[model samples]
Target: MSTLRVRPSTVLFAILAVGGVAFGTTCVEACLGPGRAAVRLARTARLAERLQLTDLCLFTEARYTRHASQADRHAAFQDHPAALEHFPSGSLMPPSGAANRASP
Candidate 1:
């Protein structure tokens, strides 16, 4: 059998293929690493946010109209810090009678 010589085009294609594979794998590794880290961090952040909300709720009551606090239903957030990138900005105003009795 005669030896076959590789053409310039073939050599270029082979180089491109190798480069693509290397870059593709590298990009995947770099991307996944940061993405997973972000997810874990987000989970912790969300937990902290929820805890803060619960703490606030524990010490306060909410009402939408001129009525004594019933403590049954009120407005609630729809997203967690982990599942969402942005949070709605607003302060939960004290109910008509809600007061801060937390120890001084």
Candidate 2:
């Protein structure tokens, strides 16, 4: 069987083709990176503009309302002296009069 020999020009052409592809890919990525980032930023800005973050019920507000009303209920249960005894002072229960206080 005869041995096969690869020509220098053919090898050079193959190497150049691979190098050109790599360089072209890098150039395309660099060109599109900033454009992609700007698109994402614009989408985020549009979503923010459409949604009202401030109007949503705050965690603290919900917690305050829940605990304050609980305290008021506990206060009302004062007639049942045994009920107040179940929850010790400084425990999970808020202060008895917190329900009437102004919202922060």
lDDT of each: 0.52, 0.59
Candidate 1's TM-score: 0.32
Supply every candidate's count of residue pairs whose N, Cα or C atoms clash at under 3 angstroms. 0, 0
Please provide, for model 2 over 1-104, each residue's C-alpha lDDT reduced to its tens digit, 9 standing for 90 to 100. Answer: 99999999999999999999999999999999889899897887677678833222312323333344444544535658564443333344455354556764
**For residue 62, what is the lDDT in candidate 1?**
28
What CA root-mean-square deviation does each model show from the true structure? 14.8, 15.0
Rate residue 69 of model 2 by lDDT: 40
Judged by lDDT against the true structure, how good is candidate 2? 0.59
| Candidate that scores best on lDDT | 2
Which residue pairs in model 2 clash with each other?
none
Deviation of model 2 at 75, angstroms: 63
